[model samples]
Structure formats: C-alpha cells, structure tokens
Target: MTIKLNLIAAACENMGIGKNNNLPWKLKSEMDYFSRMTSKTIDPTKKNVVIMGRKTWDSIPTKYKPLQNRINFVLSRSNLDLKNCKDVYASNSLESCIEKLEDNAFKSVYETVWVIGGRHIYEAALKSDSFHRLYLTKILKTFDCDTFFPPLPTNLKKVSDPDVPEELQTENGIDYTYNVYENTQFGK
Candidate 1:
C-alpha cells in the first residue's frame, strides 16, 4: 500500500518558522488553512494522520490538541507522555512513525500522512524518500525568529493545487500565499 507522506508549514520570507517555541506571527487564515488541509480526507470513513515533532505538539494550545478528528503522532526520543489524549500516539523516530503508519491497522484506517512540525522533524521528512509533497504558506513579511525550516530540495517542482487559493491572503496586516510542491523524483 502506498501512503502519500506530506509536509505542511508556513514560513516567513527568511524561511523562519518559529520563535521561542511558538509561532512568530499570528495569522488566523493561515492557521485555518492548516487546520482544514491536515484534517481533510477523501474517504469519509478514513482519517488523516499528522506526524509532528515533540516540540510542535507542545506548541499547540492545550485545549485544541490531539488536533480533533485526526490521528496525531509525536516523534520523540524522550518519554513524551500523551496517555490521556485521544487519537494521539508516540513514536521514537520518523522511521518508526512511518513504519507504524504502514502497518495493516493504520493503512486500513488512515488516508494521507502529514508531517507537521518543529525544525528537526521537518528536516528529517525532507530527507526521506517517503515524503511526497510540501504544502507551504509563503509569508511575505519577515519576522524575528530563532528556528527555521530547511531549504526545499532541488528536485521539488512547484505545482498548482486547486485546493489552494491562488490569490494572496491578507491577515493581521500581513500578506501570504499558499503553495504546493511535488517531488519530481518521487516515483522514479
């Protein structure tokens, strides 16, 4: 069974993603877009899986976590606890997370697997052959950030996605555009 592994994120002009373990900027539209994309599934009976680094999981608001209606997987070498959160699981590494997703139980229940992240998880996903697409929001303005997303691979080609809006979206006085890039060498 082939599972489409996707990476989703929003970055500033400098490719900065976060500051002090939180989002540097507030854009409700961008956050809404992320919520919709990661939670959407083509099959009504199946749910999408979001794999994130431990830090990313921590960054989410406590009340909204485990992200609702989707399966959440956190990658951490340490003992990251989530015993009370429904639909949340813990994996030691990205490889282990992917392995668990490919298992018969998960394969039958889940549709797409999205890597939503902190720096290290995004970097690891970019280096994996299993990763297929990047759903990125290009924030036009620069922000003060200490953490950044890794540069896109040379083989990834920008592709038009009908699901993404073509026009620039302005929120909280900042302009941004949604983009989708597919790996050119993915299936070859």
Candidate 2:
C-alpha cells in the first residue's frame, strides 16, 4: 500500500513533546494548526485517520473524544472495549490499524492516515519507515518532557526553505516554525 501517512508533531528544543501525559505548552494557534491539518481531507466524503497510542487518545478530553471529523484509531495491546468509545476504533498495533483501513469498509471513507503520537507510537513509526512526510513544528523553548519525540530517520531530509510559511510565529512567548521532512531514504 502506497497510501501516504503523515506524521504530525509539536516538539520543543530538546525534542520533548509531552510532560505528565499532556502537552507542556498551551499555544492556541499551534493547537489550531494541528486541528486543521489532521482534519483536512482531499475529498469531502472522506475523513483523515489519526493513529495514536492509547495514552494519547486518553489525554484528549471526553468532550472532544472523537476529535470531531477525524477518524480516531487508538492503538493498544490491552483489552480495549471499542463499544465504550463512541466514534473511535481500537487496534492491536499501528500497523494493524493502517492495514485495516484498506478494508472495504474504510477504503472509501479515509483520505489519509496521520500518525499522531505518544512516545512509543512515534518511535515505532519512525523506525519502521511507515510514513512519507513529517509535518513538524519546532518550538524554540525547552520544556520538562517525560515523553519525547523521536529523531528523524537517517534517510529523511528536511525540505529546505525555512520561510515556507513566510514568517516566524510566536505564541505565548514561544517562537516556532513549521517544516516538512520528506522520506528521501525510501522515496523510490
């Protein structure tokens, strides 16, 4: 399957993404960008699939459980009861979750899959080379992160042009920039 899987993340100077199971910083604009990217679909009839670890799924508040229009796929090895989750699906692993999307039931409904993460999920996906593009937000400040985002794969290269968005953004005193890293290692 050559379906495009995009990895989206926000990381601090030290590559830290989380602290105490939640985002360390509260940047409304950053959150908005994240919501907009992951929810976007090329076709109006299809939705994007956000594959996240169970902890990441739990971190989102119950009020925003299904993450609106995105199809939420929580990857966990535990006995997760999918019936309790309203619009979310449970999968044994990230690979299985992605493979299942090709099923007839989902083939027509999903536009793309985004590997939104927790520590383990990010590490696994990067190592497996399961994604084509990484839409990473580099936060200029360092935070106390118990969970960290993994480094880019050796074969991946940042797409130059730091000013793709045309300006630096500062929110809540934290400066950041957006960049895309393409998987040059396996681009063939």
Q: What's the TM-score of each model vs. the native?
A: 0.97, 0.92
In order, the Cα lDDT scores of the candidates are: 0.90, 0.83
Summing lDDT over every window of 10 consecutive residues in candidate 1, give the lowest-scoring window.
1-10
Tens digits of per-residue lDDT, candidate 2, 98-121, equal 688868877888887888998888
Which regions in candidate 1 have their CA more than 4 angstroms from the true location? none
Highest lDDT: which candidate? 1
Query: TM-score of predicted model 2?
Result: 0.92
Q: How far in Å is the alpha carbon of 123 misplaced in model 2? A: 1.2
> Each model's RMSD to truth, in Å?
1.0, 2.2
